[model samples]
Target: MKSLDIMIVDTPYCFAPEKLRKLLKWFFLAYIQTLT
Candidate 1:
């Protein structure tokens, strides 16, 4: 997660933060569902 944070900071131009955040939120939700 630290690495991902660094990557996000390093590549702000590559992906809009708001969109990336929404995408990450969806992915995290899916991951949680799978875990259960």
Candidate 2:
């Protein structure tokens, strides 16, 4: 439980929303390109 809490605490630093959104946008474009 403590380890899980630590992981949760650590996650935000690794998964910042701005970075995640940018990556998601790139991935979405790449995925759309593949479908066409």
Candidate 3:
């Protein structure tokens, strides 16, 4: 999770789509909550 945070922060613009990154971040947290 810490690595993921760093990835999100340091990843360059051309490497990933900003909107998808944000959507994935939201879904990742929601999925974790659903598991517990």
lDDT of 2 by residue, 1-36 (tens): 355446445555456688775665675576668679
Looking at model 3, residue 34 earns an lDDT score of 69
Q: Which numbered prediction scores highest in lDDT against the true structure? A: 3
What is the overall TM-score of model 1 with all chains considered together? 0.54
lDDT of 2 at 31: 61
Candidate with more favorable, higher lDDT: 1 or 3? 3
Clashing pairs in 1: none
In the order shown, what is each candidate's alpha-carbon RMSD?
5.2, 10.0, 4.6
The residue pairs found clashing in candidate 2 are none
lDDT of 1 by residue, 1-36 (tens): 456546545665446688777776676576568668
Residue 19 in candidate 2, Cα distance off native in Å: 0.6
What TM-score quantifies how close candidate 3 is to the native fold? 0.51
List ranges where model 1 is wrong by over 4 Å. Answer: 1-16
- lDDT (C-alpha) at residue 31 in model 3: 61
RMSD of 3: 4.6
Per-model TM against the reference: 0.54, 0.51, 0.51
Report the lDDT of model 3 for residue 9.
69
